[model samples]
Target: MTEAVFRETTADPRTQSVPLSHLSLELGHLYMEDFAAGPERLRRHFDEVRIWVEAARASAARRTGGKRPRISTCFLIDDYFTRFSTPAELVPLILKEAEEAGLVIDYLARESGCAVADRIELAESVMHRLVESPPPGSHGSRPPVSRTGWLANGQRTPTTRNALAEVTVWQPPQETAARNHSVFMDVELWSEKDGRRQWSCPFLAAVWQLARLGLLRHLGEPVLTPRPWDGEDFPHDWDRLPPLLRLNDSATPFSAYRTCTLVPNRFVAVEDAVRLILDQTDVDSGALRQVAERSAGEGAAVPAAVAQRATYVFYEEPIDSSLSEGT
Candidate 1:
């Protein structure tokens, strides 16, 4: 028998261990249209969110065996989709309204951060990691999601048929894991315009949720690590602001073993798509191992499945339905 030893240093990769809190609680999400309606919208949004915040904290404490759990509150602004007023003009208003409702936003993030944080193309990386759920009888002949730009909880209803096949009619899409009824969903991950790619909202939101769950990494290094902010004045341009900002110095760690997001009912479909995307993604194994180890050491371990680690509270939107049209 011949024994040879040839090893490459890069063969074994290590992930950066980020501080993981018990729960990362998302207080609310903001869109340009919400701001366009002025402070009243934000005031109403946070007022509704305040009660849910307390409830989420209590739930986290229960999960931690009634011990005081480390929970961090965060808010995401949709600066990627549409730019409204500058950060300088809009951020203070958001802060004031949230404060008035007795809610402190420990961290603030821009939606674009999930797309590209600190010069890393996070959305593209996540797109590459996606492992789509195959329907029954699939034999792995389908194109990868990176090329298809579409993901579904199950196989999409056929729009075309084999030229030589027998007579057929349109078929209804079916969920892969349906119990009795099928709730099929097909999500467009991105679209290209003039050679420039535009990621969909739900795709970006899934990356954002992965970041909050401490499950995201790029090339073995953590991405979207929060930068400290001491309540300083924000820049007039949205691009000047950091992707993730730590508004409160004494706040819990930004990354956590689990996450709870509170959003308006209008976002249910989007959030459902986010979960579907996450359900099939082959997340970074090194990061997953780290989270598992750290969480176990903390006494309350996270779930093995990434999608199961997220929770959401979809409350009623605090605005007139007609005024929210096209928003």
Candidate 2:
């Protein structure tokens, strides 16, 4: 009799299920510039965002057929590009402003977390999953030539040397989804300096959106799980705290079927780049199926396309011009 072989299970991966909410709403985003302008600036930003938050909640409820919808609110603080203040100093100011604005932030995350959280390189993993959309007349004879550190909607004009050694005429880039004329956009995803890579703001923002949608995983484990914050004072240093902090224990789940982000109109370009990146990324199949199955069971199915599940509301810049600029 021949001996039988047994298969090992280390290769198989499974995503841990997170409590699903009907919507995850981003209340506001803070950058170094916003913090430098002082607490007054933050209060103004949240005051404007609060109005949109209510609108988003109403829209989510309507989407769920007017039933009580589970919604979670989150805010992102910019600690990656430049650290302005310590968490002990900044977190309280943020909470105070939000409270004054009649808004509550259930979850707070650091911008750096999108690049790496819990020793996992979420941005790098997402970069590996990018599958560029092929332009028309593609016959599969050759793979799309994607430029390193950049993503574009369609093929870019080539720069080749002719037999006469003369430069070719410049051709305008085109968008694959344009109806008549092309408004092409080429987004930079990262840059290298001194043998280290810096992830772009839009790239990290895209990762943040994916995390909110519950589509991110590292070897089948959820990335950026919110750590509950006790009543004790926040750490003096920023790095002492976890990437994500759950401030409200009674708040709904952070991950949800859909997400609505309220940001300044100046971020329209960045958000557009984010959509381009998200449209190309192929998330975990098991996680995707799980969300689909669960959402359908609740009688509110989500969109098949990952990009379609995200919505954004771009508001006018606040009175403070200094806060308008920056990530």
Q: Indicate which candidate wins on lDDT.
A: 1
lDDT of 2 by residue, 168-272 (tens): 757566688887888788889998899999999999999999999999988888898899999799988878879999999999999999999998898899999
* Model 1 lDDT per residue over 48-131, tens place: 999898899999999899999999999999999899999899888888999999999999999999999999999999998888
Clashing pairs in 1: none
lDDT accuracy of residue 285 in candidate 1: 85
Cα deviation at 206, candidate 2, in Å, is: 0.7
**What's the true lDDT of residue 293 in model 1?**
88
Candidate 1 TM-score versus the reference: 0.92
- Residue 179 of model 1 has an lDDT of 85
Instruction: Give the Cα-based TM-score of candidate 2 against the true structure.
Output: 0.92
**CA RMSD of all predictions:** 3.4, 3.7
Q: Give lDDT per model, in order.
A: 0.90, 0.88
